[model samples]
Target: MIGPAALTLLLGLWGVTREHSMWRDEAATWEAAHRALPELAHMLDRIDVVHGVYYLFMHGVFAVLGDSLIALRLPSVLAMAGAAAATAATARRLAGSRAGVAAGTAFALMPSTQHYAQEGRSYALVVAAVAVATLILVTLVDGRGKPGVPARRWAGYAAGMLAAALLNWFSLLALPAHAAAVFMAHRRGATRLLTRWPMAAAAVVAGALPLILASRSQAQQVAWIRPLTWSTALAPLLLLTVGLLCADLLKRLPATPPTPRALSAVSLGLPLLAFPLLALLLLSLIKPLYIDRYVLYTNLGLGLLIGAAASALVRSWRPLVTLALAAFAALLPLQLDLRTPQSRVDDVLAPAEVVARTSRPGDGVLFIPSLRRDTAEVSPGSFTALDDLALAQSPSASGTLQGKETAPQHIRRAMLGKHRILVVADVDGHPGSARDTVKRRVLVEHFTRCADTEVRGRRVQSYERGTSCTAPPLRS
Candidate 1:
């Protein structure tokens, strides 16, 4: 278990978290943590409610460790590793040692797991809390060979559940899955679960209500998550299938009926894997919240289910080796891709660096929608020579990812006064605002495009005052 958990952390630490540039949201995380606690709370009241707790946590991390990218993302790496260990522990309790190790390995190897393992955000912490809560639930139920849960253990379960819910309000969905597990484990009476689970479940829900309400009012933050299409709708099932296959394929699956313990694990794992996904899909029919990361905790359930199957199938070391080799063969490419700088929506540093290197001292930089200026936030002095044509207030003053924007007319006037400008924009520029259109209009109508280049999912270009604008001189 320790080995697998260590492997996960080491793999996440390998290259990318530090090397890849911060994206917009990550820039948000970085900026929020540098504020005074009261200021951070005020910012949370209006925006980024979903991430407030995470920001607070990162604030503490930054206070001590300072703000290197690795330091910023280290908490997530540790949380993911803890999630793997908890997954292993839960699987071990439900099945045995072989299943536990297999489960942990599967979790560490998941590309989604790897992706979030290095993020400086709430999702990995949410997964860790849920995994630990599930482990506690298993302990409370199984009691090794005893019949009932102790008060101390029940308290622990409540604490764990509360932590998970606070980390991400959507993790409250785990309540129903936990109820299903308890019912399956104690189906003969369910009196034990009925007596204990409700108090904890209610506590978690109650505690998360403030965050849920606050985040709800800011729903526009997720306006980008469109109504699900078929392929996106099928993703959870595909992930579940992949998890099971990863384990079961190296050795033959069991033909015999599962024992009561195995049945209990299956019940818990099934709901963990399915309920959140189903709930998200159903909810999206109303308000569209179907982003995949929201349900990332389901991967642990998949690992447990597959580990249980693998335990039943593998009686020897050869089969275990075969499973390990098979998993490596399949997940290597995903691991490689996860480590790439282009793994995110874009390399934010590209535009920052391009603008820094290309623009002249008096040049202006125009960020369509203005918020895109966060691309340069990662490096404070990187674009200081160039004026930000649309910035009204700095992020520090406004307590936001992008800060306040200048009016379109002011932006136009500012732009008209500059002879050279650097432009950084999203590739398609979807959801362009009226102001964004005006900014684009001013640039194209008055300036010559000296150069334009695509950086993964974003575009970086240079422009100059018309007529006098000629091909840029060559440099060695």
Candidate 2:
């Protein structure tokens, strides 16, 4: 049991946790957690309502430990370690010991698992909680030939559900899957357990109502998500395939159906991986709410499927499975790639470095639509002398995940006062809205573009009041 978790911790710690740069979401967490507690509470009122619990938890970590890359993300690393251990215990309870060990090992090697294992956000913790809850549920339901469960185990299951739900509100979506797990775990006559379990789950849901209601107003956070597409839709299909494979394999023995425990494990894991994803996909067709990471906890079941399948495969050709696992564990190239800063879509490092070096004293930096203020996330001190021209209130004071926007009149005044202005914007080779429209109109109408450089996710341009386009461009 400990071997699997130890190996998992070693893998998670090697390069990724300490080496990779914080991506946008993690940067968001960094910004949220670094604020004063009162300000953080206010910020949660308007934005990141769904993540309030996690942000608050990290806030404590920041308060006590002080902020650094390691300090920020160490919680997630530990969470993933817990997730791996719980997965092993769940697999052990359901299948045999080999399957338990295999599941934990597979989880550690999974790319998605590794990605969140070091992430600063709450996803790793969410997965860990969900997995632990499943393990307890399996233990609750796997009492074959026994009539009633102990009162303490029932309390544990309810508490687990509450923690899982609070960790990430979307995790409540897994309740139906857990309902299926309960039903499948006791395929015969266990009406009492089934009845009692859902009542406990309901209590958990009831406990989570305040968060659900609060976060409903923050739905705009996901407004950028378009309805589901075929490409994004392949994932659930693949998971269902795994579930089907498990089902197919379970039916193979001619002399006998699988024992109650084997049946329970397969039943719990299959739905655990497949059902919620299918629901999310279907719901996404209606609302476009599907992000692979949103339901990241589902990977718990994926690891189980892989382990169970691998165990089945290993029985036939033990050498093949052993070689594959060994190769995966030793694959230095893949691990290194995962650890690189470039692994993220918009690594803040390059753009931030360019701005730090190029920006001079008394420069005015403006973020179009005002969200790119986060470009300073890694090198905040680099911009300490520069004015953030469009911000009305700081992210902390405004109670916003992103900083508040200044009125157009105020922004125009700020632009007019600055001799040199730097715009770090999402130019994406496109025009702007009323806010950007105001900034662009003021800058181009009054100043000359001294220089403009494109960075990964943004455009950085410097404008001067009287310079000409034909004039020699200043150093970038």
Candidate 3:
């Protein structure tokens, strides 16, 4: 009953959470998905990505849904619900009905879980698969090493793990933790599992090969032109872990009697907290890819541990503690999502709408190279809202003018044919040499700013060709 109720609540929250705008990354995914199949393949090959499977998945998703916000985000919400249910079922089997219900509830209300659930990418799907795989692995390990642990069960778990790896490369980070848990569960059975490592590693390699080739061929695109500091990357990870800890506390409350509260709490919390940290330390020792979303697979352990603990605590203060912690976890995220949109990465509708409203039909679209520094290149039909317009590729270097040095002749030719042009550029600060002599000479000599407009919060400079503008900016 608690499990079903918790599932219901999580599903309800999904409806409300879906109401926000898309961030830059979601726009990128949509742009890639909406491309023609051949072009899409080319694009993926050219971009350094560990998750090419998402591009293929979104391609199918958009084919049916028509690229709307609801269309983009619905799959993620469903995936999250699946994850919540799986977590509950797994927790229930390992602990008890009380722990199972609490785990599901805790997961449903988690800010990070909720955050990704509303996205349009592969994280939610990966998390869902991870939960299912975790459940199967746990079942296999926790059950007495009876000869009856079906081969089909192991096969199913392997498939899920492979699929997860394909969906998001970060899912690989959880492998060591999962393997350690499995080995500990059936010490003797560990030898058999070890025998299967060759097969498992092969599947992972096969699944990841496409992404690897795509990355090598296309080169990874970095949105941040500047190097990122360790501090900036670490801050989000720390904050996310703290949020998960608080939610876990709520999940550990006791439901019915006959459960030893203190003993259960320690048993749950120590393993939940310890294993992930150990995993992180191990990863850091070799090479650290400390992204928050990458760590999401392990979140199941935390949710389960907390649920078990909360069930234990429920022996004393049942309703109040349960409700308070649940409320606290749910409220912060709800408010943050509502007031500050973009908490979920896949809400691309509002930003796309902004692009549509600001530009006009036949007006030339200009993308300033500096703006590209933010990992957001305008979507394929970014100009569709305004008009069926041709685009002028701007210089990607910071503070550089479009058509500076390399493309003076091209810009010169473009200006001769297209008189009405909008120069679009993101003005966010990036450290690079200022506008070079070529751009300065071209702007001063050939074109003059006619009207200025802004799209998606960037300043666009409209330029008209001067009758006396004869020589190309580069030649000048």
TM-scores for all predictions: 0.92, 0.91, 0.73
* Candidate 2 residue runs with Cα over 4 Å from true position: 17-20, 144-148, 189-191, 253-259, 316-334, 427-432, 469-476
Cα lDDT tens digits, model 2, 1-476, are 68568877877786754344666778888988888788878888888878888988998998889888888878888888888999888877666666777778777787788888778888898888888888877777665415566777778877877887787778887788888866764566654666788788888999999988888888888999988889888876876787678657745622121355524446677777887788889898788988888888888887776666556556543663575568586866777777876567665545676778778899998877566778774568778889988888777778875577878899999999988988877747344557778898998799998878775555788888765644567644
Put the candidates in TM-score order, highest first. 1, 2, 3
TM-score of 3: 0.73
Tens-place lDDT per residue, model 3, 16-74, is 43455556566667666766776666555445256567878888988977777677777
lDDT string for model 1 (218-268, tens) is 888889888877888887778767655644453355532344552344677
Q: Give the Å shift of residue 204 in candidate 2.
A: 0.9
What is the lDDT, from 0 to 100, of the residue 178 in candidate 1? 88
lDDT-sorted candidate list, best first = 1, 2, 3
Per-model lDDT: 0.79, 0.76, 0.57
- Ten consecutive residues with minimal summed lDDT in candidate 3? 394-403
Question: lDDT for model 1, on a 0 to 1 scale?
Answer: 0.79
**RMSD for each of the candidates:** 3.0, 2.8, 7.2
Cand. 2 TM to true fold: 0.91
- Badly placed stretches (over 4 Å) of model 1 are 144-150, 188-190, 241-263, 429-431, 470-476
